[model samples]
Target: MMNKIFTYSLTLAFCFFSTVSYAKKSIEHCEATQNTTSGLSSCLDVVKEAVDRELQTWINNQVFILEEFALATGRRAALDMFKRSQRNFITFRENDCRWQYLAISPGTGAASAYKKCYILVSKSRIKELEVINP
Candidate 1:
């Protein structure tokens, strides 16, 4: 009975780990296909899309918090300021990433660099937004 229980436990553990490993590999498969420029572009696009979705969610949360604050405090200007600041931040992120891309040559990973910059900056902004209080 003990041996059978041990074997079953081992099998379950193996199956669980294999499933997790497969999921991770599926995500990395895009980066693995980076043998060509287009392949790398596709991988970066996937990463950028994922990060953009998360950023959008965070932005929505921030807006909601600002709206709640405005409703409670009877001050709409705070929400307006938050919206304006968010717009300005978007412009800044675009220009900054463009500058980063231009800093590199025309070819040779410029696009990837820009996409990475966007991902990093947007993720940082999401973290900042997460701390807002209504």
Candidate 2:
């Protein structure tokens, strides 16, 4: 049982690390081609800022639509839930990225990793919110 648990833990770790690696590799941003850490960091910042703006736009549009629908139909739960969920998601993103930063502490890549994590998570949330009704 102990051996099994250890193996399972290793497998999970491997999968997580490989997915992160694949995501890092698959990014087509200017950061991908940057040779210097500083250059890569700067490019990642720009990319993350763009992603953040897009995410905010999605959130704003969704909230506005939901708010209008709620006002017309007298159903506020959807809007309430959506607002709550968005708050939770933002909190989760911050904590998750903070974890990513801490995971690589004492390294030059931690900040970049944190920004990349934020970009990746926010992009996923944007996709999820895009198709949501109300």
**Looking at model 2, how many pairs of residues clash?**
0
- Tens digit of per-residue lDDT, candidate 2, span 17-60: 64465454434655658887788888887777666765676676
Steric clashes per prediction: 0, 0
Q: What C-alpha lDDT does candidate 2 achieve relative to the native structure?
A: 0.73
For candidate 2, the per-residue lDDT at 48 reads: 77
- lDDT tens string, model 1, 1-134? 46445544654464356446444333355567678877777777876776676567667655766676687799999789989999999999999999999999697889878887887787678668756521
lDDT of 2 at 6: 58
What's the TM for model 2?
Answer: 0.75
Q: Where does candidate 2 stray beyond 4 Å?
A: 1-26
Please give the TM-score that candidate 1 achieves against the real structure.
0.71
Tell me the lDDT of candidate 1.
Answer: 0.70
lDDT of each: 0.70, 0.73
Best by TM-score: 2
For candidate 1, the per-residue lDDT at 81 reads 91
